[model samples]
Target: MFRTVTRVELSELDMPRADLAEALKCCLKKVRKGHYIIKSNCPNSHVDTIRHLLREPGITFPTFRGDIRDDAEKLRMSIATRRDSLLPEDAFSHMSAALLHGLDPVEVGTERVEVTRPAYSRAYSDLLFYARDLAEDDVDHTLGYPVTTLDRTLADIALDHPLEVSVPLISEGLRERHINRESLLPRLAPGRRGRKRALLALELASELHESGAEAYCAVKFHRHGITGMTPQVTAYSSTGAFIGRNDFRHEKALVVVEVHGVGKYYMHPDGPNAAARQNHQRNMNLVNAGFKVFNLTFGDLFRPKIFEQIKWAITQALEHENH
Candidate 1:
């Protein structure tokens, strides 16, 4: 039993105070007496009343403001149903690193947020990428929220993601053993992946070590010109305890080559002294077994005098063998 008491002025009325009751009445009358058109603009001001009066089943709530919250249901419904516009973060979840580097070849279209959540965490979203049980260091920020780091990303790609995407970044970072090893090594896993990569890196690092001793050792070895004997030699104690794997041991040639790189191991107060004593003990054991051992430093290897010392030692070994 609703009726309009009197027509109210719709002129110069501010939103907060403008005749709410009368406006509601007039809107109702229009719906019943004339073709009711809910104005497309200023939807929120009129939406509540329209919904209350109409109460139509299955009709959607009218669209209003442009914000995601304002039309969240409709937008979500449209996205699920339309199939044209994908969420931004979903479209580009794994490519954030490449995108940050300005290196992504393909174009991504949406602006939705991407998130990486730990498996143990209960938190989730419709568009989030759930990363199962990520390590503490792997958690980092992408578009303000946490994502994986470059190393983690590469490792993920190395293990599970495609090789075409992973190889370029991994090879570039690891080609020079000294360049980014500290940053990259932590991300490698322990089994086959670790051992295989470690061996390759070790070979390069070992070469780099020798290059520091004498630049020509690498060049000579690679050139294959100065070859008397190669580096695989075995050392034995009278009781056979297996002291260490030697770099080079000449059979019946008393010369044992120890190559010194530029940077030594991390030094404490007695670090160098302790290292020297250990080397002396090891050399003593070798010498006691009737072998002459020679150590080479970076400077000594490069020096002509040291080269003569080596050659002289070789000649003596042959002379001793002859005796």
Candidate 2:
């Protein structure tokens, strides 16, 4: 926990903006009207500001000290803003380019820092720089200076990463109403390096995928001539009772492609998990009704060989269903 020393005054100057201004300009962040917080790396700055702000009336200047490890969770937003203060320019755009645009935070991820137009410092491991001018609609006061628009963010990620790797973020952004093609397609027209990548990503983009693994497997199935797969499909038993929903299903082939994450997401050995139990019962019912189930994971989708296995499963199921 970060240790803090508090002092209340009567001046009503609140955050003592001028004193903090003279302190570390980087760490001064507005939490709300008449209030501010600090996350300065420079202890002297904090000490000096606290001392100065304490001299004023109606002010509550709290000086925080010690390690911030335990308080990191509560300080997440502060840490993000502090990180933002480190970049050269257009810091927020870098964030949106790689991570924002309503990307699935649980699966794909979010970025800490994005260096803009980073041609010189190409050696840093933790830093990612994008070399491009901000397109129209890329920045806003609410989004902060130099953050990519939803469309531009997807285009940028698509440009930097492989289609399979980047699809989840973009697809989720699309699915979640975070972005669309009208704004994104225009931005793709200007860049040569990412034109093809962005185009392909957009072409393959679907609101159906909840994870990158699902998107990757969907595309591979398409390439493998298993075009009948419908994503996020629901299935029922032969008696017309509700069973469960499948990730990707082909009704004509009587095949269901299951993206395997429920084991980690819902399964619990020590406690009763309704989702897990229901999924198990539903799968058994589907099997009894003659539906062939195909399973894959995030890792399995990475291997090229999984496509052939999927092809075999789909082909065999189609033949059996027709017979």
Candidate 3:
């Protein structure tokens, strides 16, 4: 999340203290809200002075305050600052639109504000222009800033990035019901520069994926020629009792792969120890029901050695079944 600071425009300043005003004028960095700047680099004396002023009554700050670590929020602030500079017909597109629409960009950076213009394409220090005309249906302003529609944004990103980078966003759009697969297909039609990769991404995309991590894991599985896995599969006991829904299931090998963050157990409402106990019980149930469960963390998915082990495990299971 990116931090937002309360700003009083330099032109609107009515300072009773000359020293404070002088310090602010000298050290304040320019942001859309005015001369409000982060205090990270300011001298301790200046920071103290600014802190005192901020404490004064009737000096309310905007909702966004302090350090911002959220990428989406940071991009939003970037868009807000640059909104005034955009032409009336221009709208934020591609990755910028993706972020605005609440879709993750995966491996892409959010530093540059991508805008689509009716005229020429160009790149600037902190801005990128996609030269293309947008239909009335392709633009939206519900976010308080002009941006490409959800379908348009996904298509644009799909057309510009690789499968690994684009599939997660597409899957998220589908998962969230913001855009359907059919509406986005046309934009990635044949003869487009990245149509092949884009189409593959669309084919691999699944709304059943609960998170971008699962969608990405699907892509990785495909790339590794492991195509038998299905997302969000339910396991059942021989007597038809319900077992939990697993993240990915390979029926032929009787393997269930679960992708999750380490914090899941720790952050559960029931507490980490209880969560771990529940997880262990579930794993035992799946095993007893003739399923091999593999718990994978986000970090595990990225390690080649881990994938190699998974492949070997699945292969062994398949061979055993054959015998």
Candidate 4:
């Protein structure tokens, strides 16, 4: 394939002298000082430059993907590289590699730098280095050129992380529609370390359990006998007008159950009550429009008192159902 070549010419280009020189270097060989022809398999950077110069007002060239990455592709690859250092050669079949490939805000914070290798030393209390070989292909990349894959990521996390940690991550993936049980199951080789747990986690996962809190609330709500509540629900009026979306809603009782935390609710830097004011207004609008809105806080959901609050909210919505 490298035998056949594409020919291009260069002259007084609409660029600086240094740029003109660089353009000349993009060619396979200079036909003369002012003209040149480039090989089809020329480095992408060179080919891209030639393509750009030739592809002006009337000039057209067939688009071909070359060894050089476009600016956007370069950016993606750069990020992917920084995220994971394992090259294609290493047998990086390990969980740390998986984490590096799929590290998000939930798994590790933005500033957290992971150095995954088969070494362990407690340098910093915040930093952790797992003592395991990074098996090649143990993970897939977040970007196209990345080493680890998401399926590998799920399996590894499921195997290595605690149930509390892994379930939330898997739940978020399922709830956000980025992953599915069927796709992940096939990726798990028989006798894989985390296959059983991963399969169980996927089976119990639902798109409605958006957050760890939400996922926990779902199970607890059911245990508390709170039926008919749909998670991450959108409510609409009888006339099809848009009512605000509820974290959980029961259509039969016209009840909207929502959880609140400092992060989920947006607040202006100017004042403490800014988010409260906006939220209150929306809740009041729903109430006036004939929906019983129950605002549940983290405390309300996690504590023993959650049962009473659930009963009260359901009773209120049910009693006002006739209205």
Task: State the weakest 10-residue window (summed lDDT) of model 4.
Answer: 1-10
Candidate 2: deviation at residue 192, Å? 3.1
TM-score of 3: 0.79
RMSD of each: 23.8, 9.7, 5.2, 14.0
Task: List lDDT for all candidates, in order.
Answer: 0.42, 0.58, 0.74, 0.53
lDDT tens readout by residue for model 1, 88-154: 2322123343333222211122222233444322322323353455666665554333446655554
Top of the candidates by lDDT = 3
Q: lDDT for model 1, please.
A: 0.42
Off by over 4 Å in 4: 1-136, 140-148, 159-163, 174-177, 187-200, 203-212, 222-227, 238-240, 267-272, 311-323
User: How far does residue 281 in candidate 4 sit from its true spot (Å)?
Assistant: 1.7
Question: TM per model?
Answer: 0.32, 0.62, 0.79, 0.48
C-alpha RMSD in Å of predicted model 1 compared with the true structure: 23.8
- Tens-digit per-residue lDDT, 1-323, candidate 4: 01112232233333444654564565343432232343334454534534554434533222334522132222222233233334344323223343334432122221222334556523333234445455555544434433445565665566655454456566766766477877777666688776776665565556767566666566566557777777777876768877677888875777777888556665556455777777888788788778767787766665757666766778776877666
Model 2: how large is the Cα RMSD against the reference?
A: 9.7
Better of 1 and 2 by lDDT: 2
lDDT of 3 by residue, 98-191 (tens): 8777676545554778999999999877688988879999999897779999999888888887776688888888888657888998887678
Error of 3 at 257 (Å): 0.6
- Which runs of model 3 end up more than 4 angstroms from their true locations? 1-8, 11-74, 266-269
